[model samples]
Target: MSYTLDRGDLADLARGAALLGTGGGGDPYIGRLLVDQALRHGPGTITVLDPDDLRDDDFVIPTAQMGAPTVMVEKIPRGDEAVAALRALEDHLGRRADATMPIECGGINSMIPLLVAARTGLPVVDADGMGRAFPELQMETFSVYGVPGSPLAVGGENGETVIIDTGADNRRMEWLARGIAVRLGGVAHIAEYAMSGADVRRTAVPRTLGLGLRIGRALRAARENHRDPVEALADTMAGTLYDKVRVLFRGKVVDVERRTEAGFARGHATIAAFDGPRTLELTFQNEHLVARAGGEVRCVVPDLICVLEADTGEPITTEGLRYGQRAVVVGISTPDLMRSPEALGVFGPRAFGLDMEFQPVEDLVPL
Candidate 1:
């Protein structure tokens, strides 16, 4: 089934995307506003194409904002960066893009592609490279599946653009893009992981946008009815894309340590239990990478570590964490694709420099 995304969906999409962000992917608020404003002035509807309907040879490209999420809040986009990057890559590819997809299905990255689709009249693919957001470009499923990361296009708010052709080394592409983004005022729009429709069907996390929409809708309904939004979220997520969804900790934030380092928001947050000495510690590099309680690892990367407001259940990005904030920490299992050995190698606890081995959230905390 296909449906057009209009302004009505923005709030739910933003809220749901933020939850999927798992404490990173930047704030979706600005992206939602950008999309809302764009729709009012330009296209009234952005078409969403189902991944199963794509033809084998159709050319698909992923678009996203790159660099520090904190930087993006201060340096708002000029509303042309995504399209600029998309067009630049199309020119380099020597063919018209058949569709667009999100590099990740969280926060601003998820909405940017929809905004581009509205402007370019290209259908936005339903799938995304990461089921959740990752701090680095090389961590995408496309990169893990041996997809070429370049010829890549980077566009700046000030009309500066750069195209890179790095063959198949996505790590090199990420390195180059990060340097370029820092020079371009800490944020830039990027297009990468250009692939045929078949490759996308085989590698991309499927139906994530639709999943986000459902999650968002449920959250909204829960809040409107004065229900426990966190429990609503857990019930909504269980046995779906995430095999396990449970509140890992409920407390008040005791400490938050965050800084923009190497063009990424890097930090840790401590949440003290409401009535005990126990505390939950989250280490992050943009997204929460590890969660520990009482000196034991409760959750690790490849699985999701999400921080939410204890009452309203609003997701709190790493950049948004603050001392004394009442919070609930939730752990979610990654999709099957992300639990593979290759996927774990790239996003697991070890990949984040934590000494422990990777364990599924379900294994660590049985549902």
Candidate 2:
């Protein structure tokens, strides 16, 4: 499904995107404000397209912000780095970008491509490289499925730009860009994973943008109707790619041990149940990677462990986790494409250094 994305869609879009982001994309509030500004002065509205809408030869590029989400909350973008990075990548590739897509479907990342489209009059594809957010640049289906991530551009707020045009592997591109992003003051806008429309249709996760919008609208409607917003979120998630959604834990944040290290936000969080001694332990590198309770792993990477405000069902970024806040943790299964043996090998448990096999979140019942 394709549609026009204007300011009216942003509030809910950001809400839903934050939930789908799994807590690692850039700040959703900041991203929403940027796109709102873009609509006010740039294109006024962005056209969103389905991946199948693209011609086989159309030039598609994915754009995102690379670095700590914690850093982004304090250092707002100058509103120019996205287009600057896009331009640099376009110049390196020797062609104009026909359309832009999100490397991952996360808060800020989902908005970044629209920010670019708002500034440049390009359409945004409805699909994304990852169905949800991940920390590393290489942890995306676009790259794991054989698309090169180099010939990419990274740009800073002070107008500095770097174009990495190379045949090196995706991990190497992530390594070089990550170091540069840290040097660029802990964050930078990037354009990478240049591919054709056919490649996108084959490799990208489809309709996530629409899914996000539906989720946002559902949450808002539930709130207006005085229903349980978290229940509404789970209902909205049903019949979609992430159908196996459930409320795994309901409690207040008891502890958060977070640190900004090596250009990523790495951390662990503990949530204690409201009425029991039960607790959920979360380990993450940018996005929430694993969830465990009473020594039983409830949800592992590749599946999603999303944390939301208990009352409002507002999604929280990893950087936003704090002690004493009431929260609800949801376990959602990923699309089949993301759970395949080959795909799991790239982003599954071992990829995040967890010593466990991948299990569907639904299978991990109460301990």
Candidate 3:
């Protein structure tokens, strides 16, 4: 059966995107708002195409935003940048993309593709390159299947556009892009990793858009029906249920030691957990990369570590993590994507400079 994405699906899309993000896609809220606005303004329809439905000759591209998520919230998208990015890419390739897909499912990147689709009058595939979010561009499933990430286009907020096809590796590509992103005020719109539709079908994570819709709906329903948000989340992800934890701390961030040299939002969040003489430490770069409970390792890379509202289990992005947040710490397991050796090699503890060996959350969690 064919699938069609509509306005009502945004909530599910957002929730599913968060789930797939494995606690790392920056906040899904902005993406939801952006996409919601785009749909309302243009009222375009996104037609879902099965992988087999795509033609071998059909031009396809996976697109997203590049920069600190914190920058995105403050800078706000010019609203034209996503479409502009696609146009810039089309101009370079001298070909129109028949379809577009999200590079990742959570945060701005997830919904940016929808806006791009509306603007370009192209249908968006009901899938993404990564089932969940990752820190680097090359970490996508597209990269796993040998797709090249460049000759890409980035659209700045001021209606300016830059194209780069650095011969360097992914890290270098990140360096070059981030240099421009910083110049653009830490946010930029980009359409990259061009490939044919057939290739996208093979490399992309299928049905994630639909899954996203399911999650959004579940979250909304839970809120309206006064159901347990955590249980709703568990149902959607098929995740194991854990006892809800209390707020360890809440306070204005007294200090944040941060560095963007890694092309990620590298920083530590020290919060006064609820009570006397106690605090929680969160280490992150882009996504929440690590968490500590009273300085003891509670979670690390390849696992999902998120800071949410103390009262509500809503996620807080790395960029969104601030001082003075009354927050609860939740550790969700990473999706199956990172379990693969290739995926692990890119984002495992070693990749994050940890001396400890990797352990799947399923193994570490109490059964």
Model 2 alpha-carbon miss at residue 39, Å: 0.7
**Model 2 over residues 1-367: C-alpha lDDT tens digits?**
6789899999989988998899889887898999999899877889999887899999998888889998999999998898999999898778999999999888798899889999899999999988999898889898778888988899999999998855748878888999999999999999999899999999999999889889889988987888998779878887899988878899999999999999999999999999999999999899999888998888888998899888888888899999998999998889999988878888989988889999888788542
Reference-based TM-score, model 1: 0.98
TM-score (C-alpha, index-matched) for candidate 2: 0.98
Scanning candidate 1 in windows of ten residues, the lowest lDDT window is: 238-247
Q: How close is each model in CA RMSD to the real structure?
A: 1.0, 1.3, 3.8
Sort by TM-score, best first.
1, 2, 3
Each prediction's whole-model lDDT (CA): 0.89, 0.89, 0.69
lDDT of 2: 0.89
lDDT of 1 by residue, 232-350 (tens): 88888867878588678899999988888789998888899999999999998889999999988898887888888877778888888988899888899889889899988877777
**Residue-level lDDT for 38 in candidate 1:** 88
- TM-score per candidate, in order? 0.98, 0.98, 0.84
> TM-score: which is higher, 1 or 3?
1
Model 1: pairs clashing at backbone N, Cα or C within 3 Å: none
Candidate that would win on lDDT: 2
lDDT of 3 by residue, 52-160 (tens): 6788878887778887665555667767887888889899989988888888876667788887776666777766766667777767777766677787788888999
Clashes of each: 0, 0, 16
